[model samples]
Target: MEINLNKHISGQFNVELEQIRNDVLKMGGLVEQQLTNALNAVNNFDHDLAKQVLENDIHVNKMEVKIDEACTRIIAKRQPAASDLRLVLAIIKTITDLERIGDEAERIARVALESFNKAQQEFLVSMDNMGRKATTMLHDVLDAFARMDVDAAFEVHQSDKALDKEYEGITRQLMTYMMEDPRSIPKVMDVLWSVRSLERIGDRCQNISEYIIYFVKGKDVRHTSEDDIKENVL
Candidate 1:
């Protein structure tokens, strides 16, 4: 991915920055596919696929450590200022969020191993829509990060509220099921945890989008109102 920022005169410094960004993208790709496989495992009751996703999380953790070290080295040796410093900080924050996203995906995959009855199956399937929404948000935010596109970042940030609504709806339905059939409570709770994981993944994706905005606009949009963020970016 090409960074649109100004290139430094020192070739080595530029290469170091570029490498960190590329590594972040690589980590993001792994986490994205991990989430997809985890979602598929739950939807299809594929035990082997879920196991694979769990195993692959180590790679995600490793990548996060590697990228974080790279960012630290740049900060210590190169001493980047302004946009460069923001870029490195963004990379550090993005990788941490990505790693947490990986953890959430792993949690969802674990639910696939549980035995759910036919009645509980619909609840699991109901989460598919929210899973897909979270995955799409992740994909878009990663794309925006690569291109440093503030507009795309803003759009992803705005789309998170819809995902939240979906989460709430599914949660309410699951609670109703738990109340009606006490026997299904165990399995339904499993699905509920998975649904919560997907919702958390969407939140992390939003955090990544905020990092993208911070890197490009140099504004800490965290805890800021959506309207305030819109005014800053636009």
Candidate 2:
């Protein structure tokens, strides 16, 4: 949304770049919707919604392949340099994370299919919290990437800690529920897997945020410390 269009001198190359960016954003929207639908399916135990999530996955996969090919072609023909090169490379990384997030969502949807009838609304507090956090993180990261806003990206990165804590608490709660009532073990396991998928989605969002910083700063921060990231990222 905040792309600097003035950097381009060639109209044709600019159009190609915009096309790839548009495709990437469109793919992001699909994954975001898939994640939301998957969470709702688990929250309400809606098999229909779960099925829809699965059905929509083909589009996400297709978008990834389509965007990847476009990026490759742009690199080959445009020979983008410096920051433009970074933009193309960052898109490649972002799409990979988005696709993985989609997989996690699909996995959660499958859990819904397995345990929709087993859902205990009262016991879903932690899961709901985590799901909302993941959804917000995903949305925020996309906005940050679009705007190239380092501060916004860092905000999402910081929120990942709270999401991780929520997942741990959910694990503990589910474990206790199982121990207290062995009869509930099967149901608890189903919810556990769903929580695991949600946590993984949060992780993928964090990875995307890290990539936002990496391309902005022109340095890899994957293995860097948080303090270092703060110091290094613009």
Candidate 3:
């Protein structure tokens, strides 16, 4: 199963690397679609759609497992070092985050369905915005990975700030409503969970961006400042 970098170095290794990249991109695409569908389910208050999202989560999970196994096999057989090893490791880490993002989407969909009977229209609008932002971030992160565009990946990292601001704004508005009328507590709680789920999804996008940086530059940028990350973006 070993692939010697020195022997047949020109053609076979290049093709193998391309296959790895394509496989990772395929997995990323599936996770992106799941996030999009989950967001739509939340915004429309479509319990049937939400149920479908929940059921299809198993597929996403299976994809994650398969991708991880593929990466493991490549690393074991290819004995990739330096950049190649980093790319394989990044795919492994990124897929884990993507799978978690899918899990979060499913959690939000479940909450949306559970509150379908009681959710108020006023709160749905804010939740819809949160869902949109989360899905957009996920999409951007996956695109960055597919292209290995460091600048685009950094853009995805910085974009988390907006999602956080939106979540904070929603929190304040919901708190105001709850304070004005204690009867809004239950609905507000559901909205809180939905917003939290979206916020977590944004955080996962940041994780993906970090993995992108590591894959490209062999650096760990997590917990680092934006200025530092921007400086490293090439």
Top lDDT hit = 1
Cα displacement (angstroms), candidate 2, residue 22, comes to 1.3
lDDT of 1 by residue, 65-119 (tens): 9999999999999899999999999999999999999999999999999887776
Winner by TM-score: 1
150-176 in candidate 2: lDDT tens per residue? 789888888888988999989999899
Clashes of each: 0, 0, 0
Checking candidate 3 for backbone clashes, the offending pairs are: none
**Model 1 score (lDDT):** 0.92
Which portions of model 1 miss their true places by more than 4 Å? none
Looking at candidate 2, the ten consecutive residues that score lowest on lDDT are 115-124
The order by descending lDDT is 1, 2, 3
lDDT of each: 0.92, 0.85, 0.81
lDDT, model 2, position 31: 98
Task: Sort the candidates on TM-score, descending order.
Answer: 1, 2, 3
**Global fold similarity of model 1 (TM-score):** 0.98
